[model samples]
Target: MARPSLREKIIESGVRTLHERGYAGAGVREITSDAGVPQGCFTNHFRSKEAFAATILDRYHERTQAIMDGTLRDKGRPPVERLRAYFDAITERLEAAGWRYGCLVGNMSLEVPEQSEVLRTHLVEVCRALTDAFAEAVRAGQDAGEIRGDLDAGDVATFLLAAWEGAMMRMKVDRSPQPIEQFKRVIFASILAPGVKAGSPQ
Candidate 1:
């Protein structure tokens, strides 16, 4: 089999490094070393660390989009079940990683938005794409009468992304799946439940 190109190696290493370490913690030297390439290769390929990070973020989002395509966008399953399967897939991956690395996008959202406009802009686009994917599934559920119709689909999708990211932060801090589990429980039981809507009294 052919070996990966230097650029692919750099991006592969950068994704892992940036996910494990925050944007500020992942240095060029570390990334190159992880890729088993010369440190100078980084500057040769990327304009700057910020630019490299933006590329890595894109790579990470591609993987996320693949998961979404497989589960969230699976028309074979009911929309609510597709949503559950999507999160279940993510949970399985997090458990496999021992819950150390939360998510590259979530990590970068906290660290890079304030400093790097290139990265911040890319993050915004990535987030919007994710929200749209979620919203698509949510709108389908509402149309099928499986999710509450009174609330706006876009709003629910935004809330799901925001709350899930927050739960991920707590999961990383606590190094447990409890936060994520709680998120799924509350979300499936109330927010996404086929009932009177989230804030309404039972």
Candidate 2:
């Protein structure tokens, strides 16, 4: 097999750099050193750090979407259970990372959206794709009487995704798993429970 190109190697290093230190902190010199490439090699591959980070975000989203599909689209599990499995999978990864790197998409959303329109557009697109997957799972749950029917599945999914980002942020801040537990508890027991009125008594 052919060896990876210097550019590919730089991106491979950039993925770890971006994941570990975030966009702004991932300097070209650091990434090149991680890749064992000269600092000038980075300029040969990426126009700017934003461009390189965008590629890293693309790679991160691809892996994230695959994980989501594995759980959210599993037909053997009940629809609501599938949602639980998805969250569990994410929690395990976050815990393994010691609650750092909350999420590349969510991380970039907080850090880069204000500075670069191109990168911001990429973040928005990735977020929409993730939201669609959750919405599909919620719709399936509603059909199976596992999730509340009155709430619009799309809206519910949006809220769930939004809340999840917040929970991940808190998890990073507190360096604890309790936020994840609370998110699952409140979501399953109340928000997504069948026939439960949102923000009101059942």
Candidate 3:
């Protein structure tokens, strides 16, 4: 195997650091040191910490997008099952990390939006992409009669993202997967439950 380039090292380290520590909590010095590079190396590659954060955020989103592509976009599985599988995969990752670090996108959404307009804009775009992925699956589910048809797919996607982020926040606070499990339970049982159409008692 080949050694990672200096920029790659910094980005790999920055992704882990930023995920573990919020934007304000992660420092340039820490990121460089974690990468085993001098502080100057960060400035050499990235114009600013905010710029570096944007890079790492994109890297993080790419990982998530891969997961979505594999599961949410997998046509072989049932539409609703694909949604469950996606969350299940995410839960496994959270468990692997000991539930210490939640989603980077969700973490940054809470921390950096007010601090950096650059990051805020980037986050908005990232969120839109994520919502679109979910919306695609929701629309498929609706078409398959496995999701409520009356509800707008985009609206459901937006709500799922927001609610999942909130559940992750609660998971971090509780240091348990209960919150996440509850999210899946309620979401599957009521919100995304099959045949539960509009005006029907849920």
Candidate 4:
């Protein structure tokens, strides 16, 4: 097999490093060392730490898109139900990780928002992509007559994204899954429209 490209290696190492230690804590030397590549190779692939961080955000975006696609593309399921099921899976993930680390996008937002304009831009895009996906699902549910049309899908999507990130932040601080549970309750009771019930797939 052909050798794994240097860029791929760097990105892989970069993500692992960031996952273990937040952006401010991870360094080029640590990532390159883990990748078994020279530190200078990172510069060949990225201009600076901020640039490398952007690549990590891109990878995160692609991965999150895959998760959303897998969850929402279940044609047999109702749109609102599918969205809730996706959140259920997220809750499980948060608990399984001991609530130590939350969404990478959220973490970056808190850590690097003021330090790096590039990272802030990428983080904003991540939030937009997530909200857009949820908004699309909500729109479909409305057309299906399963979701109420009284609410604005776009604004609701933004609200859900913001609420989720806030919940994850609390989970990280509390080191408990209670915040995740609280989020689920609020999401189902308030955010999903008057009649729509949010829940995990059985």
Of the candidates shown, which would achieve the greatest lDDT relative to the real structure?
Answer: 3
lDDT of 1 at 84: 88
Sorted by lDDT, highest first, which candidate order results?
3, 1, 2, 4
Cα lDDT tens digits for candidate 3, 1-202 = 9999999999999999999988898899889999999999999999999999999989999999999988899898888888888999999999998888889999999998879999999999999999999999889888877787889999999999999999999899888999999999888776555655422223
Q: Ten-residue segment with the worst summed lDDT in candidate 1? A: 193-202
What TM value does model 1 have? 0.94
lDDT of each: 0.88, 0.84, 0.89, 0.82
Q: What 10-residue stretch in candidate 3 is worst by lDDT?
A: 193-202
C-alpha RMSD by candidate, in order: 3.4, 3.7, 3.4, 2.4
Which one wins by lDDT: 1 or 2? 1
Error of 1 at 17 (Å): 0.4
Off by over 4 Å in 3: 193-202
Model 3 residue 153 CA deviation (Å) reads 0.5
Q: What is the C-alpha RMSD, rounded to one decimal, of candidate 3?
A: 3.4
